[model samples]
Target: MLSQTTNAATQKISPDLPLTAKQAQLVQHILAFTARHLTTAGPAVFALYGDAGTGKSVVLAHLFNQIQVAARTQDASPFAHTENYFLVNHPEILKVYREIAGEHPHLLKKDFQRPTSLINQMAKDTVHPDVLVIDEAHLLLSQADHYNNFYGDNQLQSLLTTAKVIIVVFDETQVLRMKSFWTEARLEKLIAPYPHETYRLTHQFRMQASDKLVRWINDFTHQHLHPLPTDVGANYDLRVFDDAEQMRQAVVRRNQEVGLSRIVSTSGYPSTLDGGKHYITEGEFHLPWDQYNYTSTPWAELPQTINEVGSIYTCQGFDLNYVGIILGPPVSLDEHDHLAIHLDRYTDVEAFKKRADLTDPTELVHIKQQLILNSINVLMKRGVKGLYLYAHDARLRHYLQQRAL
Candidate 1:
């Protein structure tokens, strides 16, 4: 296993803050090993896996910047390779890169025109740059294989084959999109060759001093976390308000009471289920991904907010200091009167399959369940301090708390 170090204070140009010591150690190992390999020969496949708000991007930024610095300081050749590329800075790049790739067949190869060239175009024109980093990797493997507007390739393979030195950052918990290559089975297949180098960022730094948040997640996973007691809690400090107005008012009050940040989420609109009372929701919903009146609200843009109240997709590619997740109503946990009461975490495999719409009902559902378990395990472990959960369904809440106990 790779050594672990916290980088909660590493410098960053992006909105991402410093990583924790555990995160820093993982980043150090990857950069150190990657630098050594690039300086020598051959290739390597590396992955930085963690939960949301665990600072994966900060580490990636650190590595990329360091590589640039190393190249300049050491006076090494300008990291040459090929051309025609698609960077994952934003989810939209998936489409932009594809449109650009069609006319340039050379770009399709691994490295997206790196390492190997069709007719050595770079040799004719100019040398292409080497090494590539893809962030928001979980989005690559979304279920919506093709967005209504475009087609996407196996994002992981594209990165692996194209670049001699490829770095992928992803969190299974945030797998709210279509399918790509981040699933457990695909990950197993991809990493089978290099079993020893896999690195997982398990410690969290996004919550408060208490373990309330972490304990809440443990309700589904049958796991346990002992966070230091602080402001946030699963009991009295956290409650399910009547609606958005009350929630926001309480958030404001809490900010004043604790002298800390505060955020609020709506109960969310329901997706009526085929004329049934039970609604079918698309996980949590929120702005940008799901528009609302308050786009620029201070609480909406609060520094520590997770923004997962309405949509999980909104929280992708970013971490939070403290996530105030509001439990929305119209949640559909029963698929023909069946719910995974045993699930102690949000990403439970059985629960995930039960919620997903798959073709082969049983088979797809089974796979989805495993995927959900993987995701929940990752998401629950994200908060370093705590996890606070409030389910409108008293039974679900009771079940969750019992599992936690």
Candidate 2:
């Protein structure tokens, strides 16, 4: 039964999904809007945005599955009046959907690429489905930039042109690649025409109330964001450790003993030799950002992705349960007293050459510190329940604490 306060078309939340109260409310609105749009005729679209690990994808997945199941039911159900197709970025999801569809091959078509083809097939094959749901919509923007013809025009633009009803899931803050197509300006343009139809997912479902990392990030970005708790949202729990090993151990302890899901591990090295050790280590040090798909694995010798490893470059646009940040040595503050550090250089001659011309070592230090700080801010927010920090150096930990205050 729909609540008297909310839209009547909203779907009731099922018990299986562990959604927060606020998230459940939003899901209700999304489903309601979706049902309304499916029967309205012309194109309709919905947008959902939130912090990392906030269960945005999970809710969308549940709703998509629910829609498909609802469509299968008789004329008594709300969804029997409309047809639905769920499109998502993760290839794993497609496999799951295929399994769900089973031998009734006519209801679902696998290996289909074109949106037009998918929508057309759904119309011809189904009684009333015209709704399409796509997750990781930000990635679509990036893909559209590179392969514009694949989707033709931007992906969002194409969706508006094709689908009778569309739902998009994205977060503007998590744009990792510099070449992403969806900018604040572009999103503004897209939404200016439709004010009442747009919605936002604000409540954090994953991180604990103590997670203050996101507060600092939004402060920097000038975006007004808050976790569930009002006070913890003001400060960051910046823990300092002596080295990477110690940080890893602390993370393991947090997971095993404290029972936390998300922790961050960060490590930094100087890019150029200035007042510190400059040459690359002759020993077996794992290079950051290995090209061939950096999958998570535990380092028996050291703390790797034993949990989940998200580097400064790759961690953008993604969130995990727990994050362990390995703060590599050579981390320092710039003359301006902001975060700074040295970074490892991949085999990019031009980038390396640019690094060599640091007349003012202070600028390089500040840049490094800010980059790592940016990564840390993003990583810490990924945890909805809690944030644990293991700083390699006590002095640095003290500095972090002081700065966070």
Candidate 3:
């Protein structure tokens, strides 16, 4: 079945989305390298790596389309093997990509794949692409997927074996759960024997983040005790709201003017789908993530999503014009004036629960602390135009408000 990647007027996955000089350079580097691989027929792989909001997907879109155009015009093109494919593991992200790509459904679902799936498919069809440009490669699993029922121990290794040239866009920090098979160490092992090159992107093209803003974010997220910097610039539209309602109202106003905007939170419990609504909060700040049976829903791009809320899972790879964040009960500032995360209150118990149980009591706390804080940090940088924060903890909210002014 053919799938369109995106229909968003502003958030559409096209080459037109903002790209910094560094991001553009990375795209060119990958294209040139990919062309080189085709000429030599070398067994090669490349890791196009970056942090959240670093324009990794934007670059992926541009790179994928460039190859698509070249493949269609291969008689006059520069590379020997013009065949290529793009793979995605997350369905929410796949939805946005489908919306963006429109009739160009070069997407492969990782969940439906297993050890024999790719091999069997390739055996059945000889024209399956010599190159695969995979996005969200970090989400590829180590074991067989539930749906496929077929067993594949290492998905990355399978891809490396299947394709002549593989380009994976990976972010280490965005690994949401235990099932993901990619990590710095595993990445090293997977590409060590293959002819692989690495390219890095640092500038936050999505938020127009300055060095000070980036540094400030890193510092505060590492230690809530690290005093929040008051020097965050006006261009970013970073703010701390006392009430979630006010922040949401601001998001509503922005969505009217801007095409993409939404409220996301640190909470990880799947959205509550009852009576055709997905609710995620209780009390006065009643908010909902997009309605869903699961990740297959395109919550961010829908018109009705204005009323629905989003969590890290649904909104991670997608961009929005304005982002409203709910700190929920998991985060706050303590008496010693440090940012603290309470594991008990955090809704995402599935994140590091097993790891926490494995480590000793002391090490467990630190692991959860870092994972929870990192998740929040990733959410903060999702906006392209602005970031708005609503903290559930009074002290933390007050501290952030002061930093905002």
Candidate 4:
């Protein structure tokens, strides 16, 4: 049901596709609006705002196919010459969509680019489309000079000016990097002057488990360890393990039988500098991040990466049959019997050490805490079928065991 690319209009992308009944109703409204926008002339905007696994991408994918087919066939499309493009910031995500839409040639190489790169090109490309879709807007970098020498005043404004009817698929909490700039407040301010429609996806089509899992994950994300959850619901299996090797083998076994199963974890594990070949060695398990960088590496889709691990960046915006996670050092159980975050233990916060001389101690701690929590939340929600975890902290493992009852 979930074909990477829709073969035909009749091939509905999974009946359980991440869309809720209410979201579906809003999509009808968007369809009606698109028809009107195609015939009329006015600046139009729509925001697909939802948290992780809420089916935002599924909705965008369906609309993209409908619009492209309509424009190509000149049957349902309103404009005689319709120009459109689907923009994605991550290479791994782009690869998945390209494979799904194999040889469709609807999305070009230039279409999938970092927000900075695309904005720089947008300043030069004269053919602004009538419709445009931006997937994963959270990854749009705010700092222009550092990433790509992007001298644009604002990436969001440039994108808004690039198309008449534009759609942005965004998740505010998914902003893992310090550079990305798309938050709900900023989006609200940016699209304030335009005629716009906002649709939120509430139903999570990713996990077939109880809605409690979602709430529990969110609670865990914010470091609330109370009322430890039990039972991963009627249809899900979430287990906590102490042995990293055992967790890795289980993920490998699952991947061999069904596709899209892989190991992902927080950046707490150290990467050995044996000539830039990062092998995370802890006890019996020695793992490496995907052979390719998480930004571009399609680890889940590639067979070679069956043993390699993925980070929050690589697995975000995608779903898997199963997920094996290593909670690592950033998360732990405190003496007070609550989930605690250790900024020093997480390798990601090592960068903050350099800024310690200049940055406030309190603010620095807050930033690391937030980033660690965000990454964990994203990784936890990746599995569609089941979620497996191996917490480096013994106490945290026990806590997870209680939660997975």
TM-score of each: 0.58, 0.62, 0.82, 0.85
lDDT of 3 at 324: 88
Q: Write the residue-wise lDDT of candidate 4 on 1-405 in tens digits.
A: 223412221122322245566766766677677767765566688888888887777777767766766676765447435777777777667766655465454534444445555566667785566787778877765544443476655566777776778788888778775555346888888889888888777777778767877898888888777654565678887777778899888888887776678899888776543446576765899977765545333656666666788887578877777899988887888888888888768775323333212267686677667767888888988888888888888898887677555
lDDT of 3: 0.69
TM-score of 3: 0.82
Question: What lDDT tens digits, residue by residue, belong to model 2 across residues 169-285?
Answer: 776555433233344456657745542266666756545544344555455333232222334643223444444455556656655543333333444433332333332221332
Arrange candidates, best lDDT first.
Answer: 4, 3, 2, 1
Best-to-worst TM-score order? 4, 3, 2, 1
Which residue runs does candidate 3 get wrong by more than 4 Å? 1-6, 9-12, 16-25, 39-42, 76-82, 103-127, 147-150, 268-278, 293-297, 349-368
Q: After superposition, how far is residue 52 of candidate 4 from its true place, in Å?
A: 1.5
State how far residue 395 of model 4 sits from its true place (Å).
Answer: 2.1
Candidate 1, residues 1-405: lDDT per residue as tens digits? 001111121222222346667766776787666655564444466777776555666676555545544554545534333232324634222332333333343334232321123113333544343456666666553332332222334445534543456677766555542243255456657656642256676554454434555454544433222322344443324343333444444444543433222332222334322443322233242222233323222222333332224233333343222334444342223433233422232321222422243467666644544444344444333333323444445544444445443
- Show model 4 residue runs off by greater than 4 Å: 1-24, 38-42, 103-114, 271-275, 293-297, 349-367
RMSD, one per candidate, in order: 10.2, 10.2, 4.8, 4.4
lDDT of the structure predicted as candidate 4: 0.70
Model 2 RMSD in Å is: 10.2
Q: Name the lDDT value of residue 78 in candidate 3.
A: 67
lDDT of each: 0.42, 0.48, 0.69, 0.70
**Residue 266's C-alpha lDDT in candidate 2?**
46
In terms of TM-score, the best-performing candidate is: 4
